[model samples]
Target chain A: MITVRCFATVREILGCETRTLPPSSTPQLASDILRIVAGARTTDLPKPLLVAINCEHASLTSPVKDGDEIAFFPPVSGG
Target chain B: MIIRLQTADFDPEREAQALDVKGAGARVSFVGTVRDTAQDRRIEALEIEHYPEMTRAELARIGTAAQTTHDLLEVLIIHRYGRLQSHERIVLVTVWSAHRAGAFAGCQAIVDALKTRAPFWKKEISPEGAVWVPGQTPQDLR
Candidate 1:
């Protein structure tokens, strides 16, 4: 199982904080999981989006596997 | 080093007093507050959202980086989430070092890195409506 999470503006765009997907046999990348989770709203996501796998920063090309929690978020704006 | 994320407001004076500043020759504290206006629009409040574990880890990373880079003796970072009214403190970074220069640099480094690195977002609640503040990329990242 892979759990996908969204934060900040990305959360607002995705309309959900977390979603868990069933296990997949085929090899999947971060982009694939993001595309699968985002569905048709992929283009609506905020620009310069960031990805994290298992709580560490990652890129779209990063691999995804069962038990990994992937996160998509807008660039951080904090102080 | 100390790091905290809380919904309750903090008293900087109390926090400073609690720290063991005995050995340090210099101590610097920075407090970030919610502004009454954002981008020319008057705001009623600022809503801060942060990823639970990720935010903590990132803040720790920033604090450690500052400590190493600036030779800081001690560091403290306190960030608040949820809705905060104008003028309310949003974050606090305090550093102690053998000299003023290290303390100053360490505090600034933490603040600068936290602005772009920490996984926190601010939304402006205005009379018009709520809007997510736009994201900013550090010059080096671009």
Candidate 2:
């Protein structure tokens, strides 16, 4: 299973924090996972999400294997 | 020299004093606080969220990059996550160098880098509602 973590507005829009993807799609790319969930509320997700795999920043094209943890959030605004 | 992310507030003066450089003559420090207003709304608080390990990694990268650009003796960055009320400090950047030019530039570069590169995102809480700053509103995105 792949665990997808959402934050901030994406959390509010999806109404869920974590999504577990079954092993059938054992090795989906990060962008593909985002596409699947982005359908729930297409417009609500951040235009460009900052993604990370296992606490390390990653691009959407990054590979995701079963049991990997992924996170998505809006771009940083802190100073 | 030091970069940290914490939920608790920090004492800027105490932090500045902590960076002891024997021969470093110039030091510049920057402190950023939550504003009382944003998008013309009276902000009540700021709720910051960040990637745990990634935030640390990015901050360190920015600090190191700033250090490389100048003759810096030391650099410190402290950023806070979680809920913060208006006027509460959010981040601190301190740079120590042999000369004022390097110190000033280093401090500014670090702060600028933090604003864009760090993994932290803030949502402004006001009477209207909470909205992520510098981000498209849910309705707008819809």
Q: Pick the candidate with the highest TM-score.
A: 1
RMSD of 2: 4.2
Model 1 alpha-carbon miss at residue A44, Å: 0.4
TM-score of chain A of 2: 0.82
lDDT (10s digit) by residue, model 1, range B1-142 = 8999999999998998798866799999999999998779998999999998898888888899899999999999999999999999999999999999999999999999988878888999999999998876544444
Q: What is the C-alpha RMSD of each candidate to the true structure, in Å?
A: 1.5, 4.2
Clashes of 1: 0
Distance from true location, Cα of B63 in model 1, Å: 0.6
lDDT for residue B94 in candidate 2, whole number 0-100: 89
The 10-residue segment of model 1 chain B with minimum total lDDT is B133-142
Per-residue accuracy of model 2 over A18-79 as CA lDDT, tens digit each = 88877543567888888877775766777776777887667788898887888887766767
Best lDDT among the predictions, by candidate number: 1
lDDT of each: 0.89, 0.82
TM-score of each candidate's B chain against the true B chain: 0.95, 0.92
Give the interface RMSD of candidate 2: 4.3
- How do the residues B72-139 of candidate 2 rate in per-residue lDDT, one tens digit apiece? 89988899999999999999998899999999999999887777767777889999998888742122
What are the DockQ scores of the candidates, in order? 0.75, 0.50
